[model samples]
Target: MNLEPMAGFLTFWAWWVAALVLAAVETVAPGAFMLWLGIAAGLTGFVTLATGLGWEGQLAVFAILAIVSVLWGRKWAKRHQGSGPSSVSRRADQLPGRAVVLVEPILHGTGRAELDDTVWLVTGPDAPAGTVMRIVRTEGATLIVEHIG
Candidate 1:
């Protein structure tokens, strides 16, 4: 079968299939790399259908698009690093600055306190019962605290 006349159709279909496969992989594994490549492949398939490029040219276009997409993704990731908290996600890190009465005196830098009905292992200077302290930060499962007065 002479595929010469049908070259454009074949190339477009091949890239379309590749794009779908890559997109599915990205959806399942979610490494962020495959999504860009899938987008590139989809664009390449469109370009091949419109321009009727030969195999070599189609491959080149796909490769170039893949590289460009990957580079753009990296640049975007770097720019958005640690931007802010998401509304959909939980905010366990927002406990700092919340005032809580020390349930037990902090001795040798370790004690216990109750916050929001949860008992937390606290670390700070020694104080007697009923001393108020502010949460400084959390270290692992322990809450670091400081005396308020």
Candidate 2:
């Protein structure tokens, strides 16, 4: 209820400590979201220490920095999209342009194929088993393929 005794510990260094803890947790967690939050906390700590902002002002600065950092991070991610691993999450996205033999004949633009030792539902023109095909794209869980030669 009473936070007066903790006032001494709630100075600018407190933000730096919080930032370090958040960054450490981010390393052990999923997604890169917390990294940005930690950056905001660190920035807030720096500003608070330099300008001696009050607790309310420090919190306002943290919120603003967090929002701006997340927005910038999202924009940066979009700009760098597809530049990293092809299959960042969806395993099927890694199959495009990969050649695979038809495990089951495609009938009515749908069939099955094997890739990386995994059988997958595929959509393409009619092709018999043993027909080599190149995966072109994907719709849902189905791999879109085209006959190769």
Candidate 3:
């Protein structure tokens, strides 16, 4: 088989395609790792287009960019940590310090409280319905609370 055509196939479009694939994978199993690699691949495509580098040079550039981009992404993530969706699915984490009304009487140190649209299981001293309580902490899915005047 002639190797000339195959050598010409490693073009900017190839890199861009690789970048798209990496980005797609990131979407499927996201943890920010593949996203940075996708960015590196996309940038490498632009560099390849501008420099007309050979396969070896393109590979070298891609390696450097991938390493640098991943490290930079890690640093950027660290700096901006907790800036997005502070609690997201972990609603318990966001419950601390929030006051809620008891919907069900705390008959034996456990009751239901209503906050917004969801009902949360609370653990605290026995209290009657309509009592106000402040969340102190969480144990698993249960919120530990304290009564307030």
Per-model CA lDDT versus the true structure: 0.86, 0.84, 0.88
TM-score of each: 0.78, 0.56, 0.63
Model 2 residue 39 distance off true place after TM-score fit, in angstroms: 0.5
Q: List where candidate 3 sits over 4 angstroms from the true fold.
A: 1-35, 45-52, 80-86
Off by over 4 Å in 2: 1-10, 81-85, 88-149
Q: Which pairs clash (backbone N, Cα, C closer than 3 Å) in model 1?
A: none
lDDT of 1 at 13: 90
**Order of models, best TM-score first:** 1, 3, 2
Q: Among these predicted structures, which one has the highest lDDT?
A: 3
Better of 1 and 2 by TM-score: 1
| Native-referenced Cα lDDT, model 3 | 0.88
On residues 5-104, what C-alpha lDDT tens digit does candidate 3 reach at each position?
Answer: 4444468889999999999999888688999999999999888887778889999999999999999999899898865566667776877999989999
| Per-residue accuracy of model 1 over 1-149 as CA lDDT, tens digit each | 98765889888899999999999999888558998999899999999999999888988999999999999988887688645556445345778899878788888888888888888889998877678899988887788899886
Screening candidate 2 with a backbone cut-off below 3 angstroms (N, C-alpha, C), the clashing residue pairs are none
Q: Which candidate, 2 or 3, has the higher lDDT? A: 3
Q: Mind giving the per-residue lDDT tens digits that candidate 2 earns over 1-149?
A: 98754453467778888889989999999877888898999999888877777789998999999999888877888788745665657776667889988889999988888988888899889989988899999888788899786
User: What would you estimate as the lDDT of candidate 2?
Assistant: 0.84
Candidate 1 lDDT (Cα, whole model)?
Answer: 0.86
How does candidate 2 fare on TM-score? Answer: 0.56
